[model samples]
Target: MSKQPLAPSVADLAPDDSILTPYDYEHLGTYLNLLTADAEVTDWREVSRVVLRIDPAQDPQRAWQAYSSHLARAMWMSKLGHRHLLGDIPSLH
Candidate 1:
């Protein structure tokens, strides 16, 4: 079987597209990690540093934005985005 894509050290602000995008598919693991971190009551700044490779101490705004947006997208995926993943809707690109 093919290997799953590895989570990236850095990620762009998560997409706001109505449908799932290629970026979402590639960052699936990252999204899940974000969800887990939230569930575990992990601090957002710490999550940013560890998971996204962003230093909140150096760039508080950037780190917060990245963590916030990514976590929101992760929740979206858990709610409604999986329907897109399960369907054969073409052109995630």
Candidate 2:
């Protein structure tokens, strides 16, 4: 029997048009990491430039909301990873 090739990962796929630029994705990933590390820290002024690059008119309220949502997702993923590490859950294929 022949084995089929594995599909590409999500990162391998092109970003959506709304998130086309590399800067956008990079900032997003950084923001997610930081959020996961410390949800209380909200000093995103450092990434203001990156956020502006993606949408100059991005409002602070919207940005905070988006960041919060991203943080939640990251936290959930981290918890899952911890569970897998502890052998409470199977490793994700």
Candidate 3:
């Protein structure tokens, strides 16, 4: 089985009102992880190392930014992105 390729990281992002980037599509799994971690109130330091691949000891700001951004994305996915998937699948013909 083939897996989806990862998305390229961007220099800046926020908890915006839209999900229109390839980053958004590619990081769905990461977002899910972040969402789960957030719901469980996991530590950001660990979430950073595991999910965002950042070392909080080396750089705290970027790590936090990545975690929070993806957490917001996870919320967006749960609230809105799923709506897009509801009817997007097509039967192979």
Candidate 4:
């Protein structure tokens, strides 16, 4: 069976504004560029869009959790060669 895609809630989709202060946007831009450098790589288009929409007042913990969730999903896809089993975001360290 094909796995379902993750449909985050509006609140979960919101980006954390605090990231702007603690990190350089240019650095993120670089990372994003690197992630999309190879044409063979399936770019995280939706993840990038949602991350760019983070609210400045969003909680740091929540923002971190969301990022980590994205990373975890990507890792799972890489290992399994299949989409993730969409569900609740897992807690990360």
What digit string (tens of lDDT, one per residue) describes model 1 on residues 1-93?
565546655565889888998778878888999999999999999999998889999999999999999999999999999888776455433
Estimate, for each residue in 1-93, the C-alpha lDDT of model 4 and write its tens digit: 553223323233223332222122223342343234323453344343454333334555555554444454333343441322234233322
Query: How high is each candidate's TM-score?
Result: 0.85, 0.37, 0.73, 0.33
lDDT of 2 at 18: 27
RMSD per candidate (Å) reads 3.3, 10.8, 4.0, 13.3
Clashing pairs in 3: none
Per-residue lDDT of model 2, residues 10-56, tens digit only:
22122323222432233345435545446555455433324222231
TM-score of 3: 0.73
Model 2, poorest ten-residue lDDT window?
Answer: 7-16
Please list the residue runs of candidate 2 whose C-alpha ends up more than 4 Å from where it truly belongs after superposition. 1-32, 36-42, 45-58, 81-93
* Model 2 residue 64 CA deviation in Å: 0.7
lDDT of 4: 0.36
- Tell me the lDDT of candidate 1: 0.86
- Model 1 Cα displacement at 88 (Å)? 3.6
For candidate 1, list the clashing residue pairs, or say none.
Answer: none
Which 10-residue window of candidate 3 scores lowest in summed lDDT? 6-15
